[model samples]
Target chain A: MRQNRFVEKSIEKLLFVAAAIATISVALITIFVFRSGLPAMSGYGFANFLFGADWSPGNGEYGILALTAGTLAVTFLALLIGIPTGVCCAVFLAEILPKRAAAVFKFAIELLAGIPSVVYGFFGLIVIVPIISEHVLPLWQRVNPDAQTTGLSILAGGFILAVMILPTIVSISENAISSVPQDYREASLAVGANKRETIVRVLIPAAKSGILASIILGMGRAIGETMAVMVLTGNVAMLPKGILDPVATLTGTIAMEMSYAGPTHQEALFGVGIVLFVIILILNLAAQAIARKMGAVGRE
Target chain B: MNRKLGDISFYGIVLILSLATLAILIVIIAYVMRQGLPHISWEFLSQSPEHMGREGGILPIIVGTVFVTLLALAIATPIGVGAAVFFAEYSKEGRVVQVIRTFTEVLAGIPSIIFGLFGFAFFVVFMQMGWSILSGGLSLSLMILPTIIRSTEESLKTVPLSYREGSLSLGATKWETTVKVVLPCCRKGILTGLILGIGRAVGETAVLYLTIGGSIRIPTSLFDPARTMSMHMYMMTAEGISREKSFATAALLIVIILIVNSIANFISNRMKGAQ
Candidate 1:
């Protein structure tokens, strides 16, 4: 009996160690990334490192304003395309589609999530890039004959990012919509609202927090995405003046340069890491808060 | 009359939009298969690449991917299952558990690129693991930890409380009850989680790209640098050489992911049926 008790106690201790690994990893990552990156920030001055527009690693100038803007531009453009399409798809699946059709649509979305980012990047590279450069660029150039554009532009990056984040937004919003009390829909119908009106005015409004949470999560996915954007975007270190212009993102810069970076340059890349980390952290926290509110609303 | 027309059009538009999303997936898969399927042969699968991955096959890359993914799963499953058990059976709904949950969520939210940065700094540099499979596997284990924990915890939650109580009533210790009674019932759910974790680790590119050193050769040791299939494709595309080979690599990757996902679905479905 005593031996069995001893074995049980040991297993409990082991489980504690195992569970602690999660917290330990998070704390360690935060500490290591900041430690490596903070020195460069101090050397360049935090504000200058963040806000300075020029980024010439050759000349030792390191500012991330362009990269930050580029990240936001691609992410926002993606969200612009993704949010409406994803939410609409979610609504269609939850409300309009028959059960059998909804199941098929849901499976396709899951498959989209399962597809590797590298494959998406390849698709963007070979397919989207050529179409944009060969076909789309001519039309755009007609509007402004001097407009410089290529297949690899911010637009290609945004399109791919939108596709990549579609699954996330669709799945979450579908859950939120389906979870709404049946009585809410019945109530709307009882008040003489049509099916469309019940959905647009009543169901969507009720699921707003959950939809918002999905959008934030999608935004987080877009900003942190590296490989697809790295391959699709032209990787120029300047603020993109138009959607067709090639630009560099924070993630693109790090992935492109980090492998061959010098000591100081490596630390600066870590500085980019710190910025990306903090941005994603804020986005995640907001998503969590909104999801919590969504759960609370569902309970009530 | 206008209101009725507007409602009909709205439904039509939404229905078309949803179908378009599905069409995109179909188009991508069809395009990749059409381009890549012709290149797949025994030689392509078994031979090592030549000319910086421009002229030959992807045997080494496939081996590297399998090696690292297996290594990651081997390391992750125990710790992940343990953590899930701790959360489901041991930890109460309190501040400590809440903090742990928050940490896990944050870990999940952090981008793979950030994980690459952390892995490069902490594992490859500080720990001196170098740019090798060990570093890549360890980094990927961290990335998939949250997935495994959440799924396993969920499955553990579904196991009826009566099972645990019955085991204890038979004079079994809590540990014995969990292992002998509870775990057996939830084995399929846990297997599903592990398979999902394998899929995540296999599909990951950014984290492995940064930590795995991007070599094309077969790794003879864990310390040797190597490139997985995804990294092979990324490098090929980045260098703008060997477009056909990149297509083939992407096709193989898609095939592998599909197989993994189908197995996951099958297991989960069987588990559901049992329930």
Candidate 2:
């Protein structure tokens, strides 16, 4: 019996070691990125490297303003395009759709989410980019033909990102909407509200906190999406002058240059990564706070 | 009347958008099939690209992706399972376990590109490994570690404490009991976690793009640079002329993912049946 206790304690010890390893590994990664990025910090100095716009590797000037601008622009555009659609889809699945149909739709959304990011980039490059070139670009040209490059533009990247994050938003929002107890809907309906009125006025308000959390999470996904934007967004390291112009996001810059970049350039990329990390961390914390508050509200 | 019209528009909007999500999938699949179906051939699957401009086969990528993923899983599985065991079984619900739990959650939430950046900076830069399969695999192992830990921990929690107590009463050592009774019972759930981890590793592009240079040639060694299937697809599509080749690659990847996913679903269903 004593031997068995010893054996169990040892197994437990091993588990602790494993968990510690996982935490240490993540910390090591973040540390290494910053450590490698030190040269760029020394060379360009912190303020100039971040605030400068040009990212010409040949000239040894590594400003990330352009990439930062690109990442924010594309991510914001994706949110603008995706949020309304995602919320509506959530509402339709949670409220409007028949139960059987909602399940199928939910499964479909999960499948979409499961599709690799590379595949999304591949399809976007082949199908979406060309469409933008032939139709969307021409329409844009009619409005502003004097606009810069055509094929690979911010609009192109943003549209693809919106598609990429749609599943994430819809699935999370669906979870939030469904978690609203049925009694809430019934109570609203009993108060002389119709189905549409009950959902719009009562269910959504009740689920608002959770739904907001999902949207914030979706925004994090949009900002962090690397492969899709890397391929579709013309690798131009310039601040986007117009939605139709080429631009590079923070993620795109890191992925595109990390392979061939010199030590300083690589560090510069890591510096951008650090910034992206902090933003994502902030976003996640905000989401968690909102989710907790929503949980409290749900209980009440 | 005004309120009714507003509600009608809202419902109409919801219907249109919900259906639009479904429409997006159909459009994408249709487009892929239209462009890729003609190009997929058995020969293409078995062969390699002839030159820079010619239509290429994904044999190297298929081999490379599998090799790296399996290698990374070999490294990740034991450690991930150990961590899960510790979190679920060994550690009391205390500050350290909570911190570890939060850490894993943070890791899971991290963007894959950052993992790539770290791999490039650390393995390629500091370790002086150059761009190789080993670095890519290591990075991938890190990326999938949380998935394994989370899933395994959940499985461990599902394991009844009575089983452990029963084994203890029988004079079995805790280690022996855990290995004999607890692990075997949760094997199906642990296996499910592993399957999902493989899926994440296989589908990854950003991390591999940094750690493994997109070399389309067959890799002769783990230390050598090799391209993955997704990377090949990205390169082809980027070049813009190799649409057919790229489409075929996407189709092939989709097929592989579907097989993995279906197997995962099957195992999960079997687990449910057994329970």
Candidate 1 structure quality by residue, lDDT tens digits, B1-275: 99899898888889788888989999998899889978888988999999998887999998999889988988889999999999989887899877877788888888999999999999999999999999999999998888888889889989999999999999989998999998888888899888888888878999998899988888999998888988888899899889899899888888888888888888886887788
lDDT of 2 by residue, A118-156 (tens): 888888877788888888877777888686565788888
Highest TM-score model number: 1
Per-model CA lDDT versus the true structure: 0.90, 0.81
lDDT tens readout by residue for model 2, B1-275: 98889888987888888888889987886777777778988978888886752665778888889888997899899999988877766677888777776667667777889888888878886898888999999999998998888778767877788999999799877667778898898898899889888888888899888888777778989899888888787777666757778788888777777677677767766876776
Clashing pairs in 1: none
Q: Which candidate is the best by lDDT?
A: 1
Clashes within 3 Å, all models in order = 0, 4
What are the models' TM-scores? Answer: 0.97, 0.92
Candidate 1, position B196, lDDT: 83
Shift in Å, residue B176, candidate 1 = 1.7
For model 1, the local distance difference test gives: 0.90
What are the candidates' individual DockQ scores? 0.80, 0.63
> Which stretches of candidate 1 lie above 4 Å from their native place?
A296-300
After TM-score superposition, what is the CA distance of residue B6 in candidate 2 from its true location, in Å? 3.6
Top-DockQ candidate index: 1
Candidate 2, DockQ score (0 to 1): 0.63
